[model samples]
Target: GLGPEECMAVNPRLVYGRMTGWGQSGPLAPRAGHDTNYAAVSGALWGCSPADARPVSPFAVLGDIGGGAMYLMTGLLSGIVQARATGRGTVVDAAIVDGSAHMLNLMLSARQSGLVADVRGQSIHDSAPFYDTYVCADGHYVTVGAIEPQFYTLLLQVLGLAEDPDFTGSQWDKAAWPVRRARLAALFLAQPRAHWQALLEPTDACFGVVLSPVEAAQHPHMRARDVYSERQGVLQAAPAPRFDGAAYEPGEACAPGAHTQSVMEGLGQSGARAVWRQR
Candidate 1:
């Protein structure tokens, strides 16, 4: 971490971005941690799983990439813009514990507005029947998110539940959820995945099939979007948010000292380049 004061002494226009689990000035700043530990403190892990079960172990994306890397990049960009205007350096302390907590404010706002329940497995998106996953006869799973009244009506019509008395009431009625969910579960299990796909997939019902890692890149939409590419014999996702209607081709990871001479020349220390070449 560049202590801001020391780095700014040499270059006033520097945009030094530091990423860590805890913030630079906090009580746990010097401690080492990974995504899980950071998320635990940040409240990102709350309500991420069923109320009966512990929160599932998530990938590193929530804290390491989402909170840490993304925030660091945003901070760096803002600092660079400000430094250009003010001719002074900015030191960005982008911490996962801080940024992830900040991300939870959206949920807090939703709760305050009564859109989200204070308890788990009760909110529209958290565990509601219209927003949860269901299993098909073939043992595969599909998800639904028909939150709006119109879309929920469409979903029921497609699923052959248009005449069911349980689904006719307000969507937010807490007492009706379990009975409604039972009916939905039974209907979803009566047919194979392809059977439901033909009926519900074409509507504005917010439906999706739960795909595995190996099956994700093989989906029609994934193939159409060119979301993945092979590099050095390994298939990985292409860079996102394309410009000019295509992603920028990412280069392979360069080994250490790959650009040592060029960097030294840029620093006006070209004479030191020979020391590396001699080895």
Candidate 2:
């Protein structure tokens, strides 16, 4: 594999970015692994899933994209800025294990403040009745994140549970969570997901219906913002963080190695023809 020292020797101003599951150095650096292994080692996967269940893999979002690619982008951009000012480049070692652990700072801070707990089923995010998902009569699911007192009150009011004695006490009462969660589950199970969406979504209950990718693309807000587009029967997310409020259309996809010759030639590489031939 090509190393950063070799690249930097050729172009001192190059921002060489390295991404790996275990990083460029360490005992496990040379071991083959995937997103789940990196996340598990970093402790990022521990807080996910129910206490009774095995840790759920977050479909590569947590370790691969969030931990690896995003950090690499930030490092490379910062390195470019510094290189421009100092006329010298730097290597960015973006390891999924390190980046995923860094992403836990918010939860760690909350734990320090006594707002979060180390136990899997005891945290406010995991155990709270007002901050969980419920299955409806149709088997579809909806989520509620009424963590704030006012939002919890609003949720109770919308569900017509404000006057119920079971929910009259303090919202943070951990002793009552199990019973309250059961009650809420029963209530939600009596109706379909659309019923709860209609009753609570427009309110301040912090409610949302669970949706699949196809359903998300067809949602009203997503449609209004043109957040997704279909090309050749493939759905793709639009470019995000728009600049100057301008919506940019994505270019069509191309076959692999289609632009290799052009890209090498643009770099003024004399070996461009050879590279193209190898491809």
Best by lDDT: 2
- In candidate 1, how many Å is residue 146 off? 1.3
TM-score of 1: 0.87
Record all residue pairs in model 1 with backbone atoms less than 3 Å apart, i.e. clashing.
none
Give the deviation of candidate 2 from the true structure as CA RMSD.
1.8
lDDT string for model 2 (1-279, tens) is 358888888889999999999998999999999999999999999988878889988853899998999999999999999999999999999999999999999989989877688889888778889999899999999999998889998999989999998999999888999999999999999999889988887899899999888898998888998888898778888977799988788777767878887788798885877855876
lDDT (0 to 1) per candidate = 0.83, 0.90
TM per model? Answer: 0.87, 0.94
**Candidate 1's residue-wise lDDT over 1-279, tens digit each?**
348788888898999888889988878998998898888888888777777779854664688888888899999999999988999768899999988888888888888878788777877666688988889999999999998888988888887778879988888787899998888899899988878777877889889888775577787778788786666766677777798897666677566888888898999998877876785
* Candidate 1 weakest lDDT stretch, 10 residues: 52-61
User: Top TM-score: which candidate number?
Assistant: 2
